[model samples]
Target: MRPDDLHRYITERMRMSHVYQPVMLRELLKSDGEATVEQIAKALLSHDRSQVEYYEIRTKNMVGKVLTNNGVAAPVKDGNRIVGYRLTGFGDVDAEVRDRLIAECEEKIADYIERRGGNIWQHRFNAKGYVPGSVRYAVFKRAKYRCELCGASAEDVALHVDHIIPRNRGGQDDLSNFQALCITCNTNKRDQDDADFRGVADSYGHREAGCIFCEVPADRVIAENELCYAIRDGFPVTPLHTLVIPKRHVSDYFDLFQPELNAIRRMLDELRSSIQDEEPNVSGFNVGVNAGASAGQTIFHCHLHLIPRRDGDVPNPRGGVRGVIPAKQSY
Candidate 1:
């Protein structure tokens, strides 16, 4: 039979009878903690009481048979009553079964919701006035079909029109604060908070240069080209990392203009290229701009990190900027 036919047959068989009771029992063990025979029987009662009893007896008999066949010692006993059964070593069958049942439950719930005029996709936070087709097309054109983060141009990989500053934290809904990001980078930035520019300045031993990005000397001057800046004497993860600033700082990526955006991009490309020339075997790079404190952006000045990643770098290089600081310390 064809694979689809086999799949259909198996599904039909599963739905027909209490054959899947053992699988359910395993799932119960994993989720509801250790189960007594009574608990197991109660679960199987949903199928059929007679079937449940049969399976319970079958299960115990099968276990005993397996133990005897494997030449394992019999289960312990307390004066003619079997105390407990323990297997040698371990197996995670219960976990596997539980995951399958949970997935089935989720699918059923999703189907029920769909039937009731509720959309599963509707729960996702869609930006107001964003047409998915237009946004996707614009991002593709703007980034030239390449990942704005890594410069990868594979069409199979869907690109994201990401907000440089997240909308939840007062970021304006505009194209200037948008960027074309790859799946990896986009996933990484989710829920990240904008970096605190004031705190960063304090850390870097620089007086609040009054909106350093736009050269606004003191007073929160709301102006275009407002950038944030940061200094890294010795960057924790990457060496010699310094971030450029934009003064009239907006937290979203869609709020940047051509001139300011071009300048930052050029600087990063030049930096990466120069580093590659210096170190022949530099495998990859990590360029990040945190729009919020949660995302690990310490300075609010629209600053971007040019981190050079090499082979045998730090173990498990996940968490991007957050990985730089100890868990207890705030960035």
Candidate 2:
């Protein structure tokens, strides 16, 4: 066949295979000279049977015959049975054919992205790394060595400087973006990827100039003077829950100093007391804070959740932020 005809046939066959275009092209180039259909399939599909079947049909149609070594088709030996086929010297030539196929595929992909009005790099942002010492010092100063959420003092409490808006969401490596979080709250909101809650720190002036928390008729809030702010727990395993937040907006427990930590502790005490008085049958509490989306902090503003727990809350409350969170594990 003419090289142009072979290229076109190879391209059409590859399109029908449903293999990942870029990955297949890379494998073809990487082989340097030759590769088996079995080797190619193993590289592409790994253990996926659907993928193997798709490639098998495509390869047969394109190449006219199964690849072989010494007149025997390469086959996966499962006990005494031949389960799969391998490629031959002819298959190596086919790899070159696949390369031309990929160029066409890339053009199609580029056209698709252009039609959709998507910039290739529009999603990427500046990812400036943080200075650890500065971050630690900033946390200590922000919280005044207190737990911002629970108001635990630094004397016995562990503190962390948490990002109010997580780093993943274009949060800058600056002091204002950090908050003092306690061990409990820090563990809760660790590396959270949620963008809605963790709005860009610089974009706050543009987006949240109006406070969504309270209905005060003010353009800007001088202070959010309440100890415990109410927030929703999106993936609640428990029913009837709310979070407590400090009046001041801070990210983590470590961001709070002595006074702020004291305030948080006082708030928790009051909440616990109130719950005991109002709901006498209240069995326990599932208090938490998420630092980042990965850790499960959905909101950027500093807050503590007071989740009411009853018997049989969940079969396994051992997953999510609760399971692997590195808090005071005893509590």
Candidate 3:
């Protein structure tokens, strides 16, 4: 299917479900008609250098999935080199895509009002230090006429002044509470609290394109013990594919202590029990882990996949995890 067709399907499905990759690849492309993973990361992460690579890899992967032409979406290559990413047919965006973004905007507006309305109006609505003209301009100048989120410029994109503390979080309309953010980032920050607004922008809600394996959001969490937690996969190969993760942010599977391992194991059982109780059609299972980069680990965080499988989900399921190695799958 064309990218436009895919977008229509996505927008319709999103009404009843929560999806993370609601952005189209073309929406993020620069005027040069392509964007590197790192460039795209800055657009999403803004100035957060602490977790660039984690968001970068996921953005790179999402390019292949969401940006398609004739049902094929992959990176644009220049003879054994990946130059960047792009999507085809860019006159006017599909109405579905536009509607999806609008819906996202509306949801965020409501969330912001619900969370910050009373407190912000009480303090900064008509309060004295509500900086607007010259002072707000200084914040933009300090950020170099660029969006503090998404890295958009005054040339290509309009910017907005955002409260770092936010109205609900004791933020006033004064200079101290303000920062320069693109409208996209400001809207995406709606579902997030003050502390996590920037951190989880690319991992949760509609605009996300980050390493969900390592950066699982609290909302996706299903069950947890003292040491381990179970989170539903953001992009699951199968329904109810859940990950049992260690609470302490260790990367390697072997790095997990016995207590962490035991906690994960127990959570696995709890997840399986709940799946059996809830989804009776789910049959069989695929339990596995990807250890390192070469071993297929994408996020660098130790996570165990407990994927539920049904009888006829695939044409053949003899090889199971050995499907990871297509050449040696027969035996």
Candidate 4:
């Protein structure tokens, strides 16, 4: 791409596009041919590199993509751990083009401030970085220092910084998009926020066990695992009523294996925020399991209910699950 086109892609799309990779590339080349992604990101974004701190996965991804696309930087992977990248080839940034790119970023920032109304200039102006430290702390706290995926506390597992909506899914690295995950779950969810969700509906079309859960398309699935999946309840009792069902066609919840139960529980926690994003008024929940025909188990397939509770779905909110038995619902 032309130098001007590359600069436009970075400034116009950096917040939203993986195409900004080349902008990050220029900074990597400016380093003695190689540097940490953060190093490259900071050099590209800030006037003073010391003020540069851990900002967004957005930056690292752009840098990595640029390097990977150009076939110039090779990652130093230690088993599951990716240590860093080393520059192997040089399709570098010349001084003239580099100056031109910086100038373009400044102009865009000024234009953005004029169009929108925010003192976001701290960000708009070659922001040392877009995300501030305050936001990161808030994201961690909002997740209650727990793995937002498996509900494991930081004490139980190492914590992680993650994007609730991944970049591959066209998500920005903004505060609302941030989330916390334990190391293991984060590793499983890595890079999946985008492509995997899109492919889910079509990937297992042949696994039809003749039941709704088994044959249901992947798009209907809110979350899933190797053994089972979760979906919005077809006929919702509440706004975000959901069902977690095993891929197996077993009729009773008692028949669910330990792993399937574990997968359902994990997905329940992960899907909560996603539900609330659609309907913010959710105040509580009603989790239920109806076992047999006498208990009004109509579907015959084992499915766990994840019904969201609102302030007043009915006139009387008394007796909770006992309401299923009517007269027994009282005393």
Full-model lDDT, candidate 2: 0.54
Provide the TM-score for each candidate, comma-separated: 0.30, 0.30, 0.33, 0.35
The prediction achieving the highest TM-score against the true structure is 4
lDDT of 3 by residue, 183-235 (tens): 55665564444454343222212222454544566777889765677877766
Q: What is the C-alpha RMSD of each candidate to the true structure, in Å?
A: 20.4, 22.0, 26.1, 16.8
Count of clashes, each model = 38, 40, 1, 1
lDDT of 4: 0.63
Encode model 1's per-residue lDDT on 1-331: one tens digit a residue: 5657645666664454444555554655566645777766566656554344444444445666577579663665689866566655445569888699789989998888878763544523354526367756765776898778788664545466776655544443444456777665565455244575344333323334544443443443211232233344234465544444444454445565543574456456556776788787787776666666676655455556666667767665474433343222112
Best by lDDT: 4
Tell me model 1's lDDT, rounded to 2 decimals: 0.55
Decoy 1 TM-score against native: 0.30
Which lDDT value does model 4 have at 6?
Answer: 60
**Per-residue accuracy of model 4 over 5-27 as CA lDDT, tens digit each:** 76786678566433246656667
Q: Candidate 3: global Cα-lDDT?
A: 0.62
lDDT of each: 0.55, 0.54, 0.62, 0.63
Give candidate 1's total backbone clashes: 38
